[model samples]
Target: MAPRDGTPDATGAHQRTPGARELNAAARVFALLADPTRLHLVWLLSRAESDVSALAETVGAARPAVSQHLAKLRLGGLVESRKEGRRVVYSLPDGHMKRLVVEAISHADHQVTGEPWHD
Candidate 1:
């Protein structure tokens, strides 16, 4: 088969060589943020770096629960952890994280609030 321009009709859909590391990194980041608690955690951290206790209170969850979320975030590289005395503070790994959460929430707000989307 051939395209109108005489190129192969394959449509450039051939599977390119996979970049496993890059794809895995993205997947891991998303997986870490997949939890409802983690999403809220990111929002809180976007407001400012916070410790597990504060985050647990803000999210209305147990400190252990928040710790689980933080562990995932730390492993996925979506967040960084530090020690302030005996407390562990967590923050976005970089500026892009803040922008990502803000833009995503804004997009969701606009989408849900749009007239076309309203019931």
Candidate 2:
């Protein structure tokens, strides 16, 4: 079982080693997040679902740029969108993706702020 902190057990019974396919898939995810704007978009989505205009305003990018980033993210399976009237609201699909995005930003924060890391 996983520990309360979400780390795997020392016995290694709680996790399985990833295969090549899994590794490649994860690599693709990292590649998608490599862009700063895309990463910022994901970070915002992790907190709440929003539309193109809102995301564009918040990220301070042009609507077309944000739309392109969102399209890439959606195609990569990092996000999903649903139609609400005329607007398309986007959001992360699962808890794992949410945790991944949050943890990545947290790591960046620690690195930039020179803060100590915690388990």
Candidate 3:
């Protein structure tokens, strides 16, 4: 497919800092986190894992709504869960997911706080 800016063959993937597959995966990740609820979920997961009920309480969202969001995250491979009795504890899927979430949150903080990192 052509690039979003209409540069199908323009110096594009041929010289990008990242490969097409990597860029595509990144896009998928961002798309998943595009929703407000999803972003909040990622923000919470950035800290530690929690069950759906705890997530709902912390995010001020309903239990079903929180579960739905967790489902999406799980499908996207950005989250993983385990059963602790009846509660399903969710956490960042892996180091890659953690890096992506942290980068997004850092970018957001920079945008809002106007604080740029030299490195």
Per-residue lDDT of candidate 3, residues 18-58 (tens digit): 76987898899889999988888887987899999989999
- Assess every candidate by TM-score: 0.74, 0.88, 0.76
Error of 1 at 46 (Å): 1.5
Model 3 compared with the native: what TM-score? 0.76
Clashing pairs in 1: none
lDDT of 2: 0.92
Prediction-by-prediction clash tally: 0, 0, 0
Which stretches in model 2 have alpha-carbon errors above 4 Å?
1-14
lDDT of 1 by residue, 22-83 (tens): 58876776777777789899988988999999899989999998899898788878889999
Sliding window of 10 residues with minimal summed lDDT for model 3: 7-16
Candidate 3 Cα lDDT to native: 0.83
Write model 2 residue lDDT over 81-116, tens digit each, in one string.
999999999999987788888989999999999999
Candidate number of the best lDDT: 2
Q: Which scores better on lDDT, 1 or 2?
A: 2
Model 2, 26: alpha-carbon shift in Å? 0.2
